[model samples]
Target chain A: MFGEFNLIDKYFSARQAQRKDVHLTLGDDCAIVKAPDNVRIAISTDTLVAGTHFLPEANPAWVAHKALASNLSDLAAMGATPAWVSMALTLPHIDEAWLEPFCHAFFELANYYNIQLIGGDTTKGPLSITLTVQGFVPQDKVLLRNQAKVGDWVYVTGELGDSKAGLDVILAPEKRQEPFAAELEQRHYLSTPRILAGQALLNLASAAIDISDGLISDLGHILHQSQVGVSLDVNCLPMSKELRQFAPSIQVAQQYALTSGEEYELCFTVPAQNKGTLDSALAHCGTKVTCIGQIRPQGVFELLNNGQKLDWALSGYDHFKEVK
Target chain B: MFGEFNLIDKYFSARQAQRKDVHLTLGDDCAIVKAPDNVRIAISTDTLVAGTHFLPEANPAWVAHKALASNLSDLAAMGATPAWVSMALTLPHIDEAWLEPFCHAFFELANYYNIQLIGGDTTKGPLSITLTVQGFVPQDKVLLRNQAKVGDWVYVTGELGDSKAGLDVILAPEKRQEPFAAELEQRHYLSTPRILAGQALLNLASAAIDISDGLISDLGHILHQSQVGVSLDVNCLPMSKELRQFAPSIQVAQQYALTSGEEYELCFTVPAQNKGTLDSALAHCGTKVTCIGQIRPQGVFELLNNGQKLDWALSGYDHFKEVK
Candidate 1:
């Protein structure tokens, strides 16, 4: 029970009281939030490593962009409008030239979203950034993980596995070809957090989550939390042209799509009756949503292509579990 | 302009719209907070490096205790009653034996304060802990650094230099004396945040800050923020019997008292009118209050003994500036 994931549950979750104020706390993207004036707030914390999450010698702009974007993605999953942020930056040393572009990119996204950098700590240490973001949602409209129904339709915004391909391009640009590499790396470094889409789905989607981890692992969370299963058609897997071109075959591209992490896309569930209105609701969000699968009453997450079952052991990016 | 400290001031703090909701946002012990129901909340972030903040071989219990206690001290400075916490833990690996005591010590203090561990992220990295603590302070009652006035009486709770003496013992236990070592080490390892005293001083004190980076540096914050200076009585430093016994001389003990960090004791300023009520107000907090000095109208921080001025180039711990 004291495994990497369950350590938090055993130690922290087991002892807490049933706080009435907390709408949804641990085991989700964001933390407990109970605000007032009919606008309850939500909060989430994420930490990014310089050498691990981004390139060691990365564009400080991308470092700043991804650090804040990933955290905002958590808020987007919760159907909250971001309002304030507290950033704790640990730096090996202060590099002024590197910081200018980094700060420019961080505040660019922050200002566009009207989020204020309320307070933070600048300490000398390893190169890492930890951001805690707070956002506002209506009192009764928060999208939660446990609300998915068995008959709900599974939907994901934008293409999945593109960022993973982006990672491949970033790791070895010399091995990667020209045009595809640029797009793949762009998606990898600059995946937009679906904040508007989250708010749009607040009234329609029964449950929601962001795809930071690969599809299988991230979707498995919904299955476990909602106590429902899902069945997806492998043929419907949305692989990008860049990813498909980069892969050896369609099967490999599908594998990457299913198991690649850091996509920053929204995977959510809409009830059968609400499915018709889902597309129209998110039309203004500037992101496309595709019907990927349907929730089932029983059985584990399954994949089928042309009526043939396909099995694979797939997981998202886990820091503790070494992946090679 | 963009030095180590100013990097935050120039970049993060420079471009922010002052929302009316945030009473005190940047440049403080805690983040900006505005809550409803007559109880505003305070948030503060702190990151402790494994080798930097504590001994690498420090007991797991002490690691957890100091990590949480230090964050709580920030809320104490803001006169906030702690309510919730979000902890992001970076560890090289999971050691169950190490975690048992760590979680035990963490939850023990959390339960005592009635604070809930709402959410957290556990990741694999070098050992470090980043904790963001949220606490409720009454509207219009939060203490700030800029509230100090000319001629205000300055005071600190409990002894100042005991913790630093304890750190010395921790670094070189073989060279330290017996009975004195345990007491000093205990003070160093476990510092009680003066929460009750902070709340008690809300109506009595003009300004307050937790002595984290030594009295000289921390009090300097109050002086710079309030635009006032102070002359402190050298002989009046509240040094413990253990510190005096362990120190080479009374002067070295005073040196430690003036510039030692991580004390967790509060250095606060009370207006001249509230002087008489200060002792009675904080009497029930169980920490003895010591009047070290009085605020001056001008000039930098000064130390005085009887009638003569004692000068020493002293500063609290700085992560950027190396300390011998």
Candidate 2:
């Protein structure tokens, strides 16, 4: 019997009341947030749709986590500290049962980052979630894709391919019986956004991007912006034990590592002189940083396996072609 | 042949290249925005779903306008000057015919507001559009709903009931032949967000909220936030000549004025002393302002018809109830 306004008042407004930076809350036409001095606001948005982004029957809590985490990962890639977020949630129906855990997981991540849920819309429609996250970084300190210099070392945080393999486990129920299936599924469903690691890399990284698209496609962005090519060492691509065990062969595991999307891992470049400092700073954040490649002057992206060039079987998601 | 990335690069990225505040471009994991010094970044988000927010076959250009305009209205309500926006567009298919006009209308509004589309996700799904808008307001000067004073005069900008009548004309296509139907439909399709008027009221008004919901429903927010009641004069409610001709009776027109939503006009509160100054400022903006009520200390809301209390048949949109 509760209306949309009543539901929001009960679940969301109460949670939104605790933030100091929020000048106005949910009752108004818009909420006001105070941006801090000396920091430029970093903003990013993502939409997760049923069937396209996740299975319709997927757990709502995991959906909530993935949606928020993906956006947070973007701010992390920008080396901006997480601050505020707005969610426009379109639901086919207001199922309180589903909403309880979804809000729980959403607030859990929001609390972890100390991010405020400023304002957004909730309407009846096809089930989809669009979240926009904002962060702050000193004006001169924002990490950008165009700043990667030739000769800079390329580094990525944490192991790759787990989420991709985890997705496979999700799609094939029989794979659930395999060893490490639950862990892989967890990786696929509730990937951690590297906020602390990104924060740690604020000064050490020259340019950064989150590996949501495949490594090649995402790195292509840096190359196109910085106007420099990269020689990526395929052998150096990090893979978890779960990914190795789940894949049929080493090549499959390597392919997954290279082409997986939604890994939410940071791929960044640092000058050779900052290697020691970057390693030491990232070490305290408890995330594994692997040096995967080096930036080159020529604008050609190549993958090298044991010093031999290789071709990819697939090159990440393309919405148009995928639909066809 | 054009994929999501190709479409973005060809159309979106090209247009986005012109913004100076954009620290990073569309290809990055997240775009970076620089909010100016001494200004707090005001952010708001809204989602428009086909079949719910608008007709399924509505013009894509107007859909684009409504989606962005509604969000901009929120910033206007907050007395904020818009700067950047991010869009997460969900499409069932990439119909170039639809996308061309949609982008045209969307970018046109962005240019008018001097806003930049920083970054967002685009994917194939049920057709929907969600936009997050960011604006700058001086740190000390934000207008808020909670600041309405007990003795403040309640005012609203422009005619209200036209949009509701416009919507009626739309749903009942036969009504389009009625007098002033085109104007009513125009109001319904492209409700102006009073950005200039709101900016003018920044220092003069005590509190403000944009009327997206009916006057009563939205005003309830200010009452709740400010802990003050209001006695709204039904006679003072603004209704266009088109609305009067469209309605069957005067009472119906009055009801529409009270409960019609999506007017995108500013409903504000000002002290009696600032009336002259407020009038002068609003005159410069060329927006109609009508004083309709007075804020009171007693916690009660009642509609007055020529100084006599009257019951309202409708209370505006209740999303849950409407769906059921």
How does residue B232 of candidate 2 score in lDDT? 84
* Deviation in Å, model 1, residue A17 alpha carbon: 37
Candidate 1 runs further than 4 Å off: A1-36, A316-324, B1-36, B316-324
For every candidate, C-alpha RMSD to the true structure in Å? 10.9, 3.7
The TM-scores of all predictions, comma-separated, are 0.86, 0.93
TM-score of chain B of each: 0.86, 0.94
Candidate 1 residue pairs that clash: none
Model 1 CAPRI rating: incorrect
Judge candidate 2 at residue A70 and give its lDDT: 89
Interface RMS deviation of candidate 1: 8.7
Top model number, TM-score:
2
lDDT of 1 by residue, A1-324 (tens): 002123334323443434334433333212223446566557777788666677668888888889889888888887888876767777766666776677778878887776666555666667778888888777567777777888899998889878888888888869467668888888888889899999999899998888877777677667766778888887888778988878888988988888888888888999999988887898899988888899886455567887787875555323112211
> Compared with the true structure, what per-residue lDDT tens digits does model 2 show for residues B276-311?
788788887789999999988755666788889886
